[model samples]
Target: MTGSELKKLLEDSPEECHKLLMKEYGRYVYAIVYNKLRCCGSREDVEECFSDIFAEIFIDFEYREAYKGDIKNYIGTVSKHKAIDFCRRLNTVKGRSVYTEEEDIRQLASDFNVDERVDSSELRRILLDKIDELGEPDSTILIQKFYYDMSSNEIAKNVSMTASSVRSRCSRAMEKLRVKLAAAGITR
Candidate 1:
C-alpha cells in the first residue's frame, strides 16, 4: 500500500494495524531484525523484536509525523533501531555489554560540535527549550512519552484521553515544537 493508505490502515485498532503491517512487511522486517540481532540477540530475541515492531509501527502511525518516504525504508529503519535496542537491553540484563543504541542515538541527537555539518546540538537545545516553554500538563505528557518512555495508552490513562487522542496530541505538540525550533534557526 501507499504510505498514505498504510497510514490510514494504521489508524485502526492496534491489533488490526499489527496484522496489516505483518501481512505486508513481515519478511522485510524479519530480515532487518535478524541482521541487527546477529551480533547481539539470540533467535528468540530477534523474534521478539520482530513482534515489537508492529506495536511500534502502530504508535508511529498514531502519534508521530506521517511517513513521507518509502514505507519499507521507514519500517526497516525503525526495525533496525529497535533490534539494536533490544539486543543492547538484553546484554545489559545479562551484564555483557553496557553500550546501546539508545545511548548512541542520544549522542547522535546531542549538540556535539564535532562537525560543522551536523551540529544537531543547537536543534536539540532549542527543541528542549521549546518543550520547556510548552509548560505543565502538555510538557509532562510529552516528556513522559518521549523522555520517560511511556506508551500512548499509559500516557492516555494519565492524561485521561483515548490512546488515539494521545497520539494525535503528541503529533500536534511535536509539530508545534518543530516549528518553534525552526523559527529559532534549527534547520534540517
Candidate 2:
C-alpha cells in the first residue's frame, strides 16, 4: 500500500491500521532489519529493532505527514535506520570506521572481486584423463588402493604382485599424480 492508503486507514481505526500495517510489512521489516543487524546483533536485537520501527511509525506524527513514498520504502527506511542504531549501541567499533590512508581503501577494494566459478564436469574429466595417463598396474593399484580403500595386501593379491611392490607403487603413483595435477594448474 502507498502512504496515502495507510494514512486513510489510520484515520478510520488506529488498531485496524496497526494490524493491516503489520500484516502487510512484517517480513519486509524483518528483511531490512536483518540485513543491517545480522553481522553485529543477535536475533533479539533484530526483533527489538523491528518493533521500534513500527512503534516509531505509529507514534511519529511528523513522519506520517512528511513521508509521501510507498509504505514499503518508508518501513524499509525506518527499519534500516533502527537496525543501524541498534548496531551502534551493541558494537562500539562497527558503526564507526576511520580510513586513515589510501592503503586502507585499497585493502577494502582488494576484497571486492567477483568469485571465480569452477566447472566440476571439466575438472572431473581432466582428472580422469590424468589418471589414465599413469599406465597399467600403477593406475590399477592407485584406484583400488585409494578409491576403493583396499589394503596393500589385498591390492597385491588382485594385481598379482608382492605387498611391498604394491605399497611402493601406490606411493610413487601418488607423487606422479601430484606432479601432473600441479603441471595442469591444479596445485596444493
Candidate 3:
C-alpha cells in the first residue's frame, strides 16, 4: 500500500492499520531481530522484540511523522534499533559484559574522521548498497562479524564452516568490501 493510504488508515482506523502494518512488516521485523539476537537470545526473545517494535511504532504513535518517507524504511530502522536495544538489555539481564574487546577494536576502527562533504545517511545508504552487492556468504559474514560482533567460531557454527575457514572467508570478504567501498569513493 502507498504511504498516503497507510497514513490515512492510521489516522482513520488505527486498529486496522495496526493489523495491516504487522502483516506487511512482520517478517522484516523478525529478520532484523533474529539477526541481532540469534547468537544470544532465543526465538521467544526475537518475538518479544518484534512485538515491542510494533507497540512502539503503533501504540506510541511515532509513525505519525514518518509518513513523509517510505514506511518500510522507517519500520526497518525502528526494527534494527529496537533489536539492538533488546540485545543490550538481554546482555545486562544475563550479567554478561555488554562491551567486549572486539567491540572496542571495531569502535576504534570506525572512529575515522567524518568527511564534511558526505552526509552520514547518504554514506550509510551507499555502504549498505555496496554490501548487498557483495552477495551471499560474504555479505552475511561481514554483517555477522562486524555488525553483530560475532566471533569467527560462533559464526562458523552458524554458517556450518570451520572456525579457521570463517576467519579466512571473513578476511577475504573484508578486502572485497574495502575495494568496493573505495571504488565507490567512500574511503576511510
Candidate 4:
C-alpha cells in the first residue's frame, strides 16, 4: 500500500496497520539490522534490534508527519540506527573500545599541520568549521563515512539512502571539502 493509505490504516486500525507494516517491511528491516549488526553482534542482538524497530514504529512513529516520504525508508533508517546503537553497547560491554570522545579529541589534536607556525588546534577548529558549513546530511554523511570509518552500505543504512547514493554524496561532499580547504590554502 501507499504511504497515505498506510497512514490512514495506522490511524483507523493500528493493530491491522502493524500487521500490514510487518508483512510489507519485515524483510527490509531485517536486512538493515542484520547487515549492521552482523559483524559485532549476536543473533539475539539482531532479533532484538528488529523487534525494537517495529516497537518504536508502533509506539513512536508519527505516521502522518514522519512518514511523508516512504514507510520502508523510515523503517530502514530506524533499524540501522537501532542496530548501530546495539553494536555500540555490545562493544562497550565486551571491552572492544570503540572510538571514545577522548580518543576523538586526541585524534583531532594529533592531526597537525606541516607548518609549525599554524596552530594544530586552530587548524582543527577551522576544518571542523568548514565541515559544519557543508551542512546537514553532507556533513553527517562525511563524518559517518570517513571519521567513523563506516562502510558505504552502513552509512546508507544510517541515512536512509542506498549505498550508491551514500557513495555519491560522500564523493560530492569530499570535493566540496577539498575546494573549501584549497580556498583556505590548505591543499594537500
Best by TM-score: 3
lDDT of 2 at 5: 77
- For residues 1-188, could you state the per-residue lDDT of candidate 4 as single tens digits? 76778878888998898899887787568767877888898878888888988898878664346555566766777788888998898888999984569878888789855676457757876876788799868987887665556799988888899999988988999999999999998976
lDDT of 1 by residue, 1-188 (tens): 76676666666565666677786787567767776777777778878898898778877777876665568878878888888888889888888944468879788779655776555656655666788787655665787687646799999898788999888888888887788777887756
Winner on TM-score (2 vs 4) = 2
Candidate 2, residues 138-158: lDDT per residue as tens digits?
Answer: 877876675546799999998
- C-alpha lDDT (0 to 100) for residue 2 of candidate 2: 71
lDDT of each model, Cα atoms only? 0.75, 0.77, 0.80, 0.80
Q: Candidate 2 lDDT (Cα, whole model)?
A: 0.77
TM-score leaderboard ranking: 3, 2, 4, 1
Cα deviation of 43, candidate 3, in Å: 1.1
Q: lDDT for model 1, on a 0 to 1 scale?
A: 0.75
Off by over 4 Å in 3: 60-63, 98-188
Better of 1 and 2 by lDDT: 2
- Candidate 3 residue 73 C-alpha distance from true site, Å: 1.4
Between prediction 3 and prediction 4, the one with superior TM-score is 3
Per-residue lDDT of candidate 3, residues 1-188 (tens digit): 76678778888888898889887777557668888999889878988888899889885554455475467877889899999999999998999984469878889778865674368768866876787688877777777787667799988987899999989988888888899999988789
lDDT of 4: 0.80
TM-score each candidate: 0.45, 0.51, 0.52, 0.49
